[model samples]
Target: MKKLSYLFIALFSLSLMTTSCREQKSTGEKVEEAVEDTGDAIEDAADDVSDEVEDAVDDNK
Candidate 1:
């Protein structure tokens, strides 16, 4: 029947939408974690550079 086809189509669209939404959420989480890792790396590098500068200054004193 025509009504049954419409119902099936609606259900299929809804399922697809839910799957896509879940995928987006997972991707967003991965991106956030990557950004955090990058920030940590940058901070570590900065700390290393600062330590080197301090050592050089101490040597001059």
Candidate 2:
């Protein structure tokens, strides 16, 4: 009976560890996605500024 109880406890602990690892991986993916999105936004803003400058120069001509 004691051996059975120990086996149950070990299985439960292993399950919990697996779940924790999956959660950590999910969190890491979300952070990577956010960083990529931020980089895209910065690139778009730079393009807009470049276009405005070109337009102003053309107007002067």
Candidate 3:
């Protein structure tokens, strides 16, 4: 009976650990996606600023 209880507890603990790992993986993926989106937005803004600066320089010339 004691051995059976131990076996059950081990299985339960293993399942809980696996579930926690999966949750962490999903959260990590979301953070990675958000970072990528932020990078793209920054790049686009930089391009727009560059274009504006070029136009100003041309006008001055």
What candidate 1 gets wrong by more than 4 Å, as runs, is 1-25
For model 3, how does the per-residue alpha-carbon lDDT over 1-54 read when each residue is reduced to its tens digit? Answer: 999999999999999888744334588889999999999999999999999999
**In model 2, which runs have C-alpha deviations exceeding 4 angstroms?**
1-25
TM-score of each model, paired residue for residue: 0.58, 0.58, 0.57
Expressed as tens digits, the lDDT of each residue in 1-61 for candidate 1 is 9999999999999998887443345888899999999999999999999999999999999
Superposed on all Cα atoms, the candidates' RMSDs to the truth, in angstroms, are 8.6, 8.7, 8.3
What would the per-residue lDDT of candidate 2 be over residues 1-61, giving only the tens digit for each residue? 9999999999999998887444345888999999999999999999999999999999999
The TM-score, computed over Cα atoms with residue i paired to residue i, of candidate 2 is 0.58
Model 1 scores what on Cα lDDT?
Answer: 0.92
Which parts of model 3 are misplaced by more than 4 Å?
1-25
What pairs collide in candidate 1? none
